[model samples]
Target: MQTAGDETVITVYIGLGSNLAEPAMQVRRACEALGQLPESRLLACSSLYSSPPMGPPDQPDYINAVAALETTLSPHDLLAELQAIEQAQGRVRERRWGARTLDLDLLLYGDRQIDDQQLTVPHVGLPERAFVLYPLQEIAPTLVIPGQGPLADLVTRCPENGLQRYE
Candidate 1:
């Protein structure tokens, strides 16, 4: 974490996923878009992973990765930007856990915990989701998840049935 004048810059972790419209390309493009976010810089990104669909199994598999970022934007504002990116990418919210062109989830925002209707930090499913845990563990294994514990520990308890490191 750093400060720009009075504004605080927080190191945030983001999860990116796509299952449609050239999944890998969509993810790479989203990574580029993340770097372009206001007052944010992409620090490091984990290698992509291929994971089975979480919500429904019938859909296509997803391309997933986690990113570390430094940002001055408040959590809500950053969430808004992410939603905008999804909207721009032709994302349709017609079904829950449906296939998507692009999906950006704010996995961790510093060490702060937020649980509002609009956003949830340490993403509600971070601990149990293999897709998220895999890439996050890859990029920042020693990282702690505030209300939870070390990411390394979290990664251990989670099953790795559907996660494959995308080469």
Candidate 2:
């Protein structure tokens, strides 16, 4: 909701993950690529975490992390940019929650609420996914989950069965 004249920047959070090949390397490359986007600055990046596959458990484990960015792009535009980054990293959407070289999800876009075919603000599953919540908490511990109360509180309620920090 920032205007052009406002000196303050709009802050957004993105969740990144990969499990296809050299997962850690892919995550690192994604972090670097994100910072190169136009009018975007990567403010913080959570430590990489290893987590079991969410769907079709037979797939390889994923390396996940969350990133904070200050950007002037609109939510939709930011999402488009993220999609482009994924594509550049050789992402393929051939299967739902399937293994891939890069997975970039827009976790939150300046506390905005958006529901569209291509994107959902505050990400629909932010409250439930530890992979998203844990890294988010690392950078923005006091951030409220919009409808879900304090993020720390939500994290406590989340099961830790499949999530673990890398270091």
Q: Candidate 2, residues 1-167: lDDT per residue as tens digits?
A: 45556544678999999999799998999899889988788999999999999888889999999999998887888888999989988999989998999999998877678888988877888888999998899999999876667999989988876788996
Q: What is the C-alpha lDDT of each candidate?
A: 0.92, 0.88
Q: Residue 99's C-alpha lDDT in candidate 2?
A: 90
How do the residues 1-167 of candidate 1 rate in per-residue lDDT, one tens digit apiece? 77999999999999999999999989988998898999999998899999989888889999999999999999999999999998988888879899999999999999999999999998998999999998998889789999998999988899997799897
TM-score of 1: 0.97
| Candidate 2 ranges with C-alpha deviation above 4 Å | 1-8
What TM-score against the true fold does each predicted structure earn? 0.97, 0.94
Q: Which candidate wins on TM-score? A: 1
* Backbone clashes in model 2, listed as residue pairs: none
